[model samples]
Target: MFLKPLLHDFRLALIQLHVSAVKSENLQRACGLVREASAKGAEVVALPECFNSPYGTQYFKEYAEKIPGESTQKLSEVAKECGIYLVGGSIPEEDGGKLYNTCAVFGPDGAMLAKHRKVHLFDINVPGKIQFRESETLSPGNSFSMFDTPYCKVGLGICYDIRFAEMAQVYGQKGCQLLIYPGAFNLTTGPAHWELLQRGRAVDNQVYIAAVSPARDEKASYVAWGHSTVVNP
Candidate 1:
């Protein structure tokens, strides 16, 4: 009798999410996608930043949920049902009444694996285009977070945090084989900076980098530049 080979491999799914003001609708869409990815044999699925809410400082307070709040609960249930690892993406989390842009990860068993609040806020001014002041509504995260999975050691980073090479280096130093960034890069920077930044991070760290961005929203207060991508080491 021939024995089947034991495989210790992993596959990733990047969700180029399209967010909206309706949190319930977005959650339903994300859950559906996650299920589809799992059915397609993805062991891990990642969603874009602010998947549970709208991006922009103005909507932070209104959309903010607690860490283990509704958004996380929904993601946890999905992760458990699909038997896959899930990066729940960044959501506006209300911590002690202050808002923080946060990302949560769940294991195959739906256990909370790790959480990372966006350390670098998107605060920039581009002439004749968009202006973002994340600090005005959201507080910056002070601690760095990483976790282990069945596939490999993984690093976590939210949208603007990807722009910092130092952070990526830190993850590389921590023995991370793959880094996940959930973000919403805008039209102003998305076209010029998004892919370049992902490639740069992968080249610099010599590791796989996956970035998930919310699909473009032209009618919303802030338009998202969406081109969800994955790059290998």
Candidate 2:
């Protein structure tokens, strides 16, 4: 449904980034896209999951970095430059010898507002289809992430976290008006529940939902189902 924009509305832009193996190139491309989106009047911009690296369990450690490392530093610079609330999509984060899928948020002043690790790891096996195990290389986060903007209160999550309705409910109960999830659903589950899950969460919470995803790359090791979407209440 087309929810009409309010007089004091904010424009949210989702970048369906095409991830590559080259970490530097991916970061550069993502910053450029954020700039372009901001120039076009996006006050809040979000990137796709693992925009700085290809999606897969094997590649997590290779591309993982500290929070204040290279990737988030760029995100901070760009957010300040554009004067926008920037959601630096999910990345492979290395902390305490454990790797976690984490999403970082930055304010217009370049201050990081929140760091949400993927609370639920995506581990599923479907016979004759897709079998993936994130828990093999990644650890789960124990908290929910939320922040505030001039326009509304925002809740944050990574890909797999959207599947759990209870978490979204908690965010809703905590007075979040919008929920953002940077996801990279695979070919097997993307078509099946990607949009469905987002809609379900939005309806259940009575809020808006933005589920951003990486653009599909045919040559990537693990293909991502790229249908970045937003659902209104």
Candidate 3:
């Protein structure tokens, strides 16, 4: 069932999510956006990274939830309601004693299709410039994720994964035509290479790349770069 070829046009909805400290509020906002996009004729709807929680390592453990938890459950139900494939942005997932940055994918039937844990952890520090460390609290995923859709094979990658060309090549070589990345690049790095990275990946792999990011909130302590856009194959 997963190996079949899909060759057709697909309308993708990139949910420019607005994240907050309030988990419930973020979920509600995302749901509304998903419904709105589905009504507009999108076959697939996606949310940004950390859509249900604030984008900070200090807050990850506090906001972490197990799979089938509140956020995933609501996203699944919404996907079923709208009858569209849903890429449930990245969420902080708690499994046993470890926590991971995970992205959940749901089919139109509302069943979970894939849970791609972010393989690359963002850990960069430039002293006075900017410093963020995900590896300090989050565990990295061990495998790549790809799934079939009505249009083609869709690949999954979280924020930092976009910087890796080999990762994109692996997916492209495996016959994926679209790469869906739920990312939240900070203002520092976003302005420098966000669009450049997306376009570069598409041109290199000859695949469509859509990057979904949370809307920038000035009041929030951690501001996300909210430039959610897609590039052609």
lDDT, candidate 1, 15-130, per-residue tens = 88778889999999999999999999999999999998888788899988888989999999999999999999889999887889999999989999999999998899888887
Evaluated against the true structure, the overall lDDT of model 2 is 0.93
Cα error, candidate 2, residue 28 (Å): 0.4
Model 3, range 95-121, lDDT digits (tens) per residue?
998999999999999999999999999
Model 3 pairs in collision = none
Winner on TM-score between 1 and 3 is 3
Show the colliding residue pairs in model 1: none
Candidate structures ordered by lDDT, highest first: 2, 3, 1
Task: List residue ranges in candidate 2 displaced over 4 A.
Answer: 1-7
Give residue 83's error in model 3 in angstroms. 0.4
The whole-model lDDT of each prediction reads 0.89, 0.93, 0.92
Q: Give candidate 1's TM-score.
A: 0.95
- Count residue pairs with overlapping backbones in model 3: 0
User: For each candidate, what TM-score against the reference?
Assistant: 0.95, 0.96, 0.96
Highest lDDT model number: 2
